[model samples]
Target: MRAVILAGGQGTRLKPYTAVLPKPLMPVGDMPIVEILIRQLQSNGVDRITFALGHLAHLVQAVLGNGKRYGVEIDYSIEDKRLGTSGPLSLIRDLNETFLVLNGDVLTDLDFLDITRFHADQKSTITIACHKRSVNIDYGVIHRDGFRVTEYEEKPVIELYVSMGVYVFEPAVLSYVDPETYLDFPDLVNRLIHKNEQVKIYPYDGIWFDLGRFEDFNRVHEIWDDLKPKILSHE
Candidate 1:
């Protein structure tokens, strides 16, 4: 299978560390997060992988080399400038088949094979890996009917399923993205939906960390001892 890993982000959210290294290169446990993801992909039957690169592109290439050590063919697509998220896909060639695309900064034990199968079986244009997340409000929440206070609740929590930055795309969907300019994946997905294309979401109920935020980055170390084994185990 072929996959494109988005490694181009400047990772502004991760300040000082990103200032020196690309977010994908950030260390998690012993190996860099992207490296772990690459190994996971390889083990899951992805033989050809491309790194969509921009900021500190040279450093990343230097660190990962030809991907021989990882047992997969490594290739890259250079973004002359920042191209939002999925915009970099426009720069790659021969995406004429179903492919997997994802952000390199994420840490997850999700089975890529399952995702690929789901995409094929469903005949989907695009499938987003989703996870349910909840956020609680610390303050009391209030409901009002104009001039009257109707109800009040303390620290109400809101829950929603959010994209985990992993996706499967059929080559036909590539037409939706233009050659250049800033176009985020979310925008592209929405555009496809508006056009009545089949965009599916695959719910995930396992370990995941974006590592784009400071708290999440720290959480990796806190959970590594437990998460590592699950991620490494093929069974």
Candidate 2:
């Protein structure tokens, strides 16, 4: 399988740490997060990987270095200026077959082979890997009908299905993207919907985290002992 990993974000949320090191290069347990991702993909049968990079691109290339050590052939597509999430895809070439796209900073033990099979069986234009997350609301909520309160609930928990920044895409999907334009993943999905393309989601209940967030980054380190085994099982 071929995959494109998005590692270009400025990681503004991560601040000082990201100022010097790209989020993907940030250590999770002992190795960088992107290294874990590459190993996972390689073990799951992905042989070719491309990095879509911008900020600190040179550093990423320096650290990863052709992916030979990781058991995959690595290449890169660098953006001259900022291109929203999906826009970077326009810069990559030879994506004439089905491919996978995902964030490089994500930490997840999801089986790439399974998602690839799911996408193939469904014959979907795009498939997004999804995880269920429960968000806690601190404030009270109220329901009103023209200023008359009908119901109220305090500190409710809401469950939502969020994208894990992992995706399977058919090459045809690129038709909607205008080269060199700023386009985020959400906007691209909206466009796919407008065009009546088959866009689906694979619901996964497993280990997943966006290391871009400070809290999640800290949490990973807090449980590194346990996470290390599951995340790097192939290694």
Candidate 3:
């Protein structure tokens, strides 16, 4: 299987830490997050990996060095200009089969092979891996019918299914990508929907974290010893 790791963003949200290193290169538990991801992919049946790179591309190249260390083949697709998440895929050639695309800074135990098989079994144009997250609202939320208040809830916890920045795509879905245009994943999903293509969601209730966010980054560090075994476990 093949996988594309999106490691290009400047990681503006990470500030000083990212100022010196690319977001994917940011260390978590003594290893670069992307390196850990590479190892996970290899364990999950991915032998070929491509890095969609931009900001600090050289540093990433220097650090990962062709993926041999992880027992996977690594290549790079550097963007001349900023291509939104999905745009880089259009620039990458030879994706004539089902493939995986995900953000490099993701830390999750979701089985890559399992999702790939799920996509194939469903015969979907794209399958997005989603996770359930709860967001707590601090203020009382009022539901009104015109001017009359119908309901009110105090400090409600809202449940939402959020993208885990991982996806399995069939080659047929590439028809929606325009090589000249910059596009993000959501917009591509919308386009697929507009065209009546099948898009599916694979909901996961596993331990997952988007290390791009500072809070998750810090939390991972706090719980690394407990989480590392599971995150990197081949089982």
**Steric clashes per prediction:** 0, 0, 0
Q: Please, what are the lDDT tens digits per residue for candidate 1 over residues 166-213?
A: 999999888998997789987999999999999999999998888887
Best by TM-score: 3
For all predictions, the C-alpha RMSD in Å is 1.6, 1.4, 1.3
Instruction: Assess each prediction's global lDDT (C-alpha) against the native.
Output: 0.90, 0.92, 0.92
lDDT of 2: 0.92
- Two-way TM-score contest, 2 vs 3, winner: 3
Best by lDDT: 2
lDDT of 3 at 142: 98
Clashes of 3: 0
**Candidate 2: where are CA atoms >4 Å away?**
144-150
What TM value does model 2 have?
0.95
C-alpha displacement of 215 in model 1, angstroms? 0.9
Specify the poorest-scoring 10-residue window by lDDT in model 1: 226-235
Per-model TM values vs. the true structure: 0.94, 0.95, 0.96
- In angstroms, give how far residue 231 of model 1 lies from its true place: 1.2
